[model samples]
Target: MNNSLLIKYGLAGVGLDIVSSADICKHVFHTKASTKRMHTKNDNNNTEYSAVQSEPWSCTERCFPKLICCTYIHKTIANAFHPFIFIPGDGGSQVEAKINKTNSVHYICAKTSTDFFNIWLNLELLVPVVIDCWIDNIKLRYDNVTRRTSNTEGVETRIPGFGSTEPVEWLDPSHASTGAYFTDIGRLLYFTDIVNALVKLGHVRNQTLKGAPFDFRKAPNENQDYFVKLKQLVEETYESNGKTSVILLAHSMGGPMSQYFLNLQKQNWKDKYIKCLVTLSGAWGGSVKAVKVFAIGDDLGSYMLNGKVMKLEQITNPSLAWLMPSRNYWKMDEVLVQTDTKNYTLSNIEDYFMDVEYPNGWEMYQDTLPHSLNLTAPGVEVHCIYGTNVSTVEQVFYKAGSFYENPTLINGDGDGTVNRRSLEGCKTWSSKQKQKVYDLALPKVDHMGILKNVNVLEYISNLVNGL
Candidate 1:
């Protein structure tokens, strides 16, 4: 980052106030500030190939899973917004990103580390040594990590659709007509104890959420095979009935993933089957969780011990293995640098994105991802479902997975993640749809609860039947 770039970005205006669970290597650098990279001499060339640092005892990276996972999801989902522009937020930290449920016009904004160039530039080659190091830290994924793990894995239990060496026979008789259950998201298959319990809900007013079958092993990148699989599923299902009748029920990250699929369809480049698309707690718009993560590193144990993570205890129960803790954009030595706090030890949590703001038109919807799909594909029964239950998470995080900000934006309704206005477009969208965003609100459901809530399911089922 050059001085001119720094001046242009105005990164110093923001504050770094939050948690961190960066990798052990990062933590060593943070706590000791004296740890050096440890590289071994190449046996053949007898030359030091590179620097591989030896980290001491730091456990932040080894444990914080949800933060890292969600971080990747944020990037994967944010990628869906690249076809449009994202405007910068009030703080200039995040360029608001949004997703349009109709036409699927996505808006995205990306700005790299604001502090690295200031401190890590080598000064001679005009090259960013520190930024390069930070890049090396996170660039691991785009460069080799994604490639390295495409086939090899050591997962404890593989979900149904995704690759898994271990056999999971939950569904004795697979729904040949409907296709496999969504075991990829939730380890439990549809035939297993969970989905059955949930289906029982439709019969006896029972409440059972078997969890998502789509396991986000790595947030499905637009170019990944998973995207192709999703597209294929949409096509097969839509054409299965010989037409688009079934609804696409997606939650959280799935919402954006599905949106990306539809966006591809809009370009006349996608060949996925589909019909109605429903988003539940869909992070069509970015989540406040990302903002909070960047502000605070994921030191959950520390936060839990200190009682700070309790702030989110309600919104995101037990911040699983998707949260990455590299959200801070500090200003150092005139360059803007973004470094993943990493685990307290030297472990690298997954979700690591660089600090380069790809001018891929990612600045239009600063807070919203892409919000044009509804207008693009008006034929699709585009419905937005949100949970209205407020938890300690939303009470502090501003927006968990619900929309609760800018009351003037939508009318003051939120699904713990999305606020009322954030659901669709401005006033015009509302006049056309009325309270269709909520249809009917579930008083006390949390973010995930919307997917499992009986009321929400009924609402979805009814909507599907109408379609």
Candidate 2:
């Protein structure tokens, strides 16, 4: 697409240059030498304490070379506050890809590697022709025998700043393309508002506050390494904070991933290390939107973009399969996808995949479905905060001979992305676990909007303060 077309599509003033992820990382993770000390009164205790603002803490060079895993921390006299770890949702983390493919899908695609560059949130790569290259590099390949997914051959991908908030806060650190132009249309700032709110509350980044941004392409089953790292981060954060329990703040797919992680641990481990679980717009049960994304492409709510172009890459992601409307939440008889010949429900999702001509989706679904099917409680205090009163996709209708073509979407109540049933699926945990489950329904808040919603932020602040 041309500059004019991009401008018309809400990607105003298209910049032709590609910014390297290394440059953005350096700029975002750079540390300053300035330090200042100020006295402040604690609101809760009415006691005066010295607060020192210094350079952010980072992992040792031995652990993460050439990468700044820094977290902003404010040194205070009292260190009794609860530390937090943020887990990001789908497409919420920045992914870097180094091209070394033996074969090329198109001449325009990158096949040789100079260095790693940001593939996700790199607007320059998402342009019409270049996106083909991106699709190839970002797509995953599933192994039927191993029942797992791997990156495209010769394409090495990694999540930058695994233990820091920088990757999840602003996807594009340069803030040039999508951040500068498409903010009104799509999400550029992921967990920025929440991080800022926590900072304001004197929760230090990387010290008292940290982020766990995993490779969102694969489901939890395929992300054992990430979960292991997450466990260490939580434990380390807890130990660093005087053995204080860590609070897990998760969003969307992160919620389910966190739940799975919690389920894997012993009750004693959870009781000793975890404070509570707070999920914002949690897909406690998966969303119906995934089914539609499988059938027809999702423009990510941007009408100007062609969703069909990215369909193949999206379908290859096992995480998308994991996000399909959960059998635990959706009734067997409830129709999720409608066709001229038949309607599909939770019981016949495999047929829906076969009809869509991507039978591999069934294998992926089977591999991931077990992770969330039980919906077991995390055995800790839970706070499920999600949006409501927004029209969400409930069912999709495909006309005769139009399975891959445009389909009609039937809307139902949700957060404009997840259905009400999925959002409320956390309610099931209330009765299953001994720990308290708190539910907060914010009206008129959309999925991404919940991250920056004033009410939601205020609620989080209060919750953190009270804790």
Candidate 3:
């Protein structure tokens, strides 16, 4: 086999010197060999070498070429525990795109490509001039007749490793060089810490722990296939783990998505398959942030980036419309956006969209509004964990000439991303359902910080261990 192929298989680091000659002989010649560690010293440089006893196994020349020995790495068998399914929020999953476009928006943009490349979290595409290309490639197109969205013409996209944690834990499998430099900026950008914590707590990845990352650009209404697969995955995981119920761990929009999934299932199915639902920084009732996202776009908390650059793509996503401020939480007269001549509230959202010159946004918003309007109880035990005490955008103000440009933000109590009312909306489930609802509000923890916060991690560990 080629050395580069071995490296790609993650075996290049394994030293052949560690395998004993006796083990290789036993595998090759079918001779019974006694396992023993051998120590030797090279005559030229007087270099000492120690060889570990390797397990005898079948080997072929095509498999290892010159190497005839292989080592078996032992793995610990975890005890029975509640399986976990991590559902990521919007833009939390890694998305790979293949370009097959017949037309190009820019001369530099590729019209066709043979390989799929990471479109999201690949910072290389997020740079100044290239970001436009990335936006065009990742943007979705809504069909008025279907009332559903599809990828930009000629671009095919897929979420990799649907039933594994690796894709969600490290969005860009390559971890692009930029991510290394900005790793400390946001923990929610990746779930590495959370996955590591679960692994340390005796949860084996892919067996006891899995991930459900979908096309975050679309809302749950358009995710029927995803829901079907998620149901099968949950049942398969439960049966594989000695019929142990699963803990649905969700973050941000995943919280609502999980709830929607649960609502679709039968009560007995939830009672049997679901251990409990644990949501971190759940946007239960939507957020005022979505209003701003519609008004003038958002950098998604990145201050250095221009929000307008991504507005075209962000506005096209139906999921963002589903995350708009819900009437169930926001009052009718309460203003979410204020301009020189008019103030916009939840009741006047269509007018807000009309004034912004994106009437199509109102269509998308109306299509997705009914899905999250009721916020029905999922009929499962719930643990809602969220952050508070940080200032979040509650409202936006625009000057006369600057309707879609620079806007002033009015801050309110939240987790720096979601409003407090929305974060605490899960509390409404307490009296609505038979299952017990536990709400945890951690002070001074921002939205992404909740993922890696020491206290939050400890709490999750304790909860999983106890279950």
lDDT of each: 0.30, 0.78, 0.78
Q: What is the TM-score of each candidate against the true structure?
A: 0.38, 0.82, 0.82
**Tens-digit lDDT string for candidate 1 (346-394):** 0211122211122111121111222322323322335666656453222
Per-prediction count of colliding residue pairs? 119, 1, 0
Sliding window of 10 residues with minimal summed lDDT for model 2: 69-78
Compared with the true structure, what per-residue lDDT tens digits does model 3 show for residues 1-467?
Answer: 11222222233223432322233333433322334434465543432324434343355432454332332211011124688999988878988999988887778777888899888778777777778788889998888888888888899998889999987787678754443344323622467677777765546688788999998888888888999999999999888766778999998989999999999999999999999999999998888888888766777556556778778788989988898888888898899988888989887888998988877788889898888796789999999999999999998988897876779999999998889999998999888999999999999999888888998889888897676
The best-first sequence of candidates by lDDT reads: 2, 3, 1
lDDT of 3 at 246: 92
lDDT of model 1, residue 249:
51
Candidate 1, residue 288: CA error in Å? Answer: 1.3
Give me the displacement of residue 297 in model 2, in angstroms. 1.4
